[model samples]
Target: MPRDTPYLQVADEIRARVLAGEWAVGDKLPSRARFAEEYGVGQSVAQRAMERLIIEGILEGRAGSGTYVRKARERRRMIRSRIHREGGGSPFRSALKDQGSAGTWECNSRARIPATEDIAARLAIEPGDFCVMTHYEFLADGQPAQLATSWEPMAITGGTDVLLPEMGPRGKIGVVARMRSIGVEISTAIEMPRPARATREQANFLGISVGDLVTQLERIYFDSEGRPVETADIIVPDIRWEIAYEIEVDDSRF
Candidate 1:
């Protein structure tokens, strides 16, 4: 039988200790010298073992602070549905309310920005077309929870009271209500979700480590004529929220 490498052996022992509740979450780990002495290995070996656990998310290293066991991640539930749109309330706020947390959001809107190819494709408009772009940062209980960048074609909303998503009479109401006010009756919305690693920008906004797990939802709203009215890319951190879909069953069809 082959023997395990020194670092692997030490790592396994430490993991076992953690699982056995030798140290509670957020407990600072022993110094490298102490671990080396306890494991009968070189200090380098002990360091390697700790580094491996850090990457695995069992531990975290704080600058200017000692290494500590990472706290268990809190998972909040987020439900996506047409009901939320029809309700005319912020979906993030609604989800947080369901979790007993107060949700608030800050938004900034920029108009006359040229749409990128991807945004153009999603909005079904030509590249370089003018669009009103809005960036939103949503917080739950004073903690960053989600980020969203939404775009609407100027051809659809320009010279209207709803040109800016967060201004005017229908401002901050919601996409469905705002579009309806402009004589565009939204009939359908499509969402495509994909798992991805957090970028540095996203990590900064969500107060998480870079490369953390995130879900990117590409959402598009369409009118009765199948014209794309608005599109948004919403970012949800996996450590903070669990994405759920609420689909209605069609008993009539059955």
Candidate 2:
């Protein structure tokens, strides 16, 4: 509409530079005037590109200074809604495996009150169901990376250790991996990304400020027969994690 026909293309050029390590994080980007001149384009085009990148959390703009590349952090390379798409495995485990070395988790389950509407729906057992809730605080390199809570219907996993009141999984094994040993193949998963404010407990668990930006991922796991099995909600510090998607463009016709 504004003759900035390919604004996303222009932004991709800058994003490639950032991702390639040519321009490190926190480095000041070229001024708008300079970029416009370099690309032989109007200032509006360059401005649009910068604005889009800022909105995508790739860059930051300061009032007195200039646009700066955001400090690169441990980025998430995978987020699959379906378990079999990304190598046919548990999406959450795949996501964590790619970001960094998997750290030990303290896993435990308890009979918890269904406090939120979302939880009630995910468990699919009614509003006040005695839910079997699993808690895990995952770490990477001995530092906290994320905290996750999973809820399941007590009717399905009622008498199992899924509702044990222990401190954690004493053996420190991933729940998904544990499920597989019991011949329950996790066949479906759904992930939702949301911007959330950190709670006091989440802040302490994540080692971040109470007001820091956080991206929360809610994943629902289902069995091969399409029955709901588990629902996991993961909290990741915004500054510490990123999600990337790569699409191939074929120009064979051209």
Candidate 3:
């Protein structure tokens, strides 16, 4: 195994102290100068270790205030499932409703933008094909909770009011209902999620530090004909939320 760096070793020691209850939650920690002297490392190394802990949600740095052991916050569960909704609505909103919280989103749409290679692969379109793209900032109880960037081929929704996801007669409806309205039935939605590090922009939006852990969830909707209709990258912050999948098991076979 590769040897750990000095700063990481220092961080491990600090984390061990914290875990051993030497520093309780919300307890202010010593200054970096003190830590540097105590650990026999450079002050910069101590700073980096503290920053790493901050990014890991173990410590919190307040502006002009000393770093402190982070207070534990309750992480809410974000459920993804084949929820059967009778009418049209975003599944995200439905999910928040289930939790007794009001979920709202701010969205901006761009039409006729060329699909990037990644998006094209998800949509089964050639790169540079025109598509409609929308970026969503989802809020739960007025706090930014999730983010998504959705793409749809213009060939599928061109010239329709629904071209913009959050506009027209049936706006804010989910891909399944929206596609059904346009004569295309969305048959399946497949999602793949992996751990990711937050970018500067995502960190700012989600009120987390850069390099904080997040979940990059890529979901694509397929029509009954097996043609891709829409694709989106759903960003969920790991510090504040946990992902859950609801599986409805049928016992008739048993």
lDDT of each: 0.86, 0.68, 0.89
Best by lDDT: 3
Give one digit per residue, the lDDT tens place, for model 1 in 26-49.
899998899999989999999988
List the candidate 1 regions with Cα displacement exceeding 4 Å: 1-20, 25-73, 84-88
As a whole number from 0 to 100, the lDDT of residue 171 in candidate 2 is 27
Candidate 3 structure quality by residue, lDDT tens digits, 177-196: 77778888888889999999
lDDT of 3: 0.89
The TM-scores, one per candidate, come to 0.76, 0.56, 0.77
The root-mean-square deviation over C-alpha atoms between each candidate and the true structure, in angstroms, is 5.9, 11.4, 3.9
Query: What would the TM-score be for candidate 3 when compared with the true structure?
Result: 0.77
| Top candidate (TM-score) | 3
Instruction: Give model 3 RMSD, 1 decimal.
Output: 3.9
Worst 10 residues of 3 by lDDT: 1-10
> Which wins on lDDT, candidate 1 or candidate 3?
3
